[model samples]
Target: MAKPKILVTRRWPAVVEKRLSKSYNATLNPTDVAMASNAIATAFAKYDAICPTISDKLPAELFPQSRSRVRILGNYGVGFSHIDLDAAKAAGIVVTNTPGVLSECTADLVITLMLMVARRTSEGERQVRAGRWTGWRPTHMMGAKVSGATFGVLGFGRIGRSAAKRAHHGFGMKVIYYDAFPIAPDLAAESAAQSRDSIEAVLHEADAVSLHMPGGAENFHLINAERLALMKPTGILVNTARGEIIDGQALADALRSRTIAGAGLDVYEDEPTIPAALLQTNAVLLPHLGSATRATREAMGMMVADNLDAFFAGENLPNRVA
Candidate 1:
């Protein structure tokens, strides 16, 4: 039988690329640049399976109106909001994502962001590098204290709970969360987290808020100007979740006016295209490094490989999302 032909949209880790190449007739993007939409559309006709990462935007229009030769979309990341599930389903495509492997690393980045923003580490590093740092004084670069503060979580999924535990156990902070579907009491007790009735309740009380929710139309701009107003003036916000959850312009305005103390973001509403207003603010921004660790990235790729293997063998997909 002929080997299954597959197209990887972006370059994966070296180990993953080697493993994938061994199993299937894989075409890897050597440049590591994002594939253009037209190229992706062509992939549908050429490859038996298309492996896509978050950077690839597979909308309804991208799917062929006629039947596509592609059978499965083995997504490299946990979040599938980038892929239009409705369109994939209509076109008889199965979509699978890698979820469990990335939870700890992503949560670690959340804490890293929270601490960097609260302690003003990014600003301090810039000052030192720019040759502007004077000797330390009692009032030099005063910043918020993360230890023993109230940490609020917007979503209590795997990553959210992991962050809550880090705040509570690692830093001696209080953890409170609000999830659409509350977790079990025992699971909540692990972090000693209390469930709030609404997102507003969590925002109003937390000293620092971390977002771990999914992104879609329902959560688009969910944390807008009005909701931001509910947060304490001393509060800081961190988002490792989808960027659309918070309005970039509103967050920039809040930072400029000192409505909130600071923000640390790993993800943005639009990837690689942050609002010009946000760049001018004191916010600490990162280029979506939530699961960038070597181990995590490899694990995510292996998970995708597992799903693809199962798919080709006509076995149950390990992480089918659609």
Candidate 2:
């Protein structure tokens, strides 16, 4: 029998590439750029598995036409919002994402963004870079405090719990969170977080809000104008989750109108095209750096490899999106 054919989405670590080259017939994009629908159509034509990322889309229109082909989409990151699940289901393809491997890295990013916004690190950077920093004046570039502040977590998953641990243990923050399903005892005990009855209550009480909810229906634009308006004028918003969770236009308006004090975003509604108004405002914007760490990337890649090994060996996948 011949080896399985796989199409890697982009350039990976040399070791991983070498291992893949030995284990299977792997095809990589010539330019090492993000996979497009046309390229996906072409690549999937001969390959059995298509390694993808959150940026790649596996629409039905681009499904492989070969009977020997069945997808094992090896997503580099946890988020599968880019992949059309229904389309994949219709195409009889199995989609896999590297999930737990990214929780710590993303949690660290969320905390880092929150701290940056609360402590005005971005402003300080701006001041220093613009050569405007004459000295450390008493009231110059001063921002909110984190200690003794109330922290609101939107969805308490592995990443959320990790962030809550950092907030509670690192700082003396009062922790409260809202989840559709009640948080398990392990999480509450682990993070020292209190459960709130409603998301509104969490918004009302928290000095800073961090979102970690999974993205799907019923969550798109959950934090709209009205929800943003509910936050205190002194409240700070932080999101390392999906960009669609918050309305960028509403968030921009909120910042302009001072609806909320400030915000830090690791993701955006549009991946590369951020709102110009947000860029002009004091809000801290990040270019979707939630899981950008080198160590985390390697782990994600390896985990996907493990999932593939399990699948090819006729065992259960390590992390299944379905």
Candidate 2 local lDDT, residue 283: 85
- The sequence of per-residue lDDT tens digits that candidate 1 reaches over residues 168-233 is 999999999999995999999999999999999999999999998899888999999998989999
For model 1, the run of ten residues with the poorest summed lDDT? 59-68
The lDDT, on a scale of 0 to 1, for candidate 1 is 0.94
Candidate 2, residue 278: the lDDT equals 85
Note the Cα lDDT for every prediction shown.
Answer: 0.94, 0.83
Model 2 has how many clashing residue pairs? 0
In TM-score terms, which candidate is top? 1
Residues 228-292 of candidate 2: C-alpha lDDT, one tens digit per residue = 99999999999998888998889999988998999999888777788888897778888888888
Q: Which lDDT value does model 2 have at 23?
A: 81
- The list of candidate 1 runs beyond 4 A from truth reads none
